[model samples]
Target: MATVEVDQDLCVGDQICASMEPEIYEMRDDGLAYVVDGMEEIDDDDLIAAAKDAADACPVDAIIVEE
Candidate 1:
């Protein structure tokens, strides 16, 4: 399984990650970041790809995945 995480300190409030992985990424009201995937863990390769694309698209480079 793969896991996605965001470093709020580095998030910069960008929504690119959200756009890239709407199933997993969202922005906080305070302009930080959060995982809204509605789950506590990642389960497969497709989820990992979506998370990776979101990470790659984030200008601030805040998203990360553990596989």
Candidate 2:
């Protein structure tokens, strides 16, 4: 399984991760991006790929995706 997380301390509210991978990431009211509820652990290959893409797209490198 692949796991994804956004480091709140490193998040810059850029929204790139959320935009690139809405299924795994979301922008909260605080303007920071977070991993959507129940989506931290991913089993689908497509979702895992998207998470990796989002991580690479994050300007602050706040998104962490691990297999």
Write down the lDDT of every candidate, Cα atoms only. 0.78, 0.92
Q: Pick the candidate with the highest lDDT.
A: 2
Q: After superposition, how far is residue 53 of candidate 1 from its true place, in Å?
A: 0.6
- The candidate maximizing TM-score is 2
Q: Which residue runs of candidate 1 sit more than 4 Å off their true CA positions?
A: 37-40
Model 1, 1-67: lDDT tens per residue?
8767889988888678777777888877998778885533788778778888888888888887777
lDDT tens per residue, model 2, 1-67: 9988899999999899888778789999999999999999999998999899999999888888999
> What TM-score should be assigned to candidate 2?
0.96
TM-score of each model, in listed order? 0.85, 0.96
Error of 1 at 28 (Å): 1.5
Worst 10 residues of 1 by lDDT: 37-46
RMSD of each: 1.5, 0.6
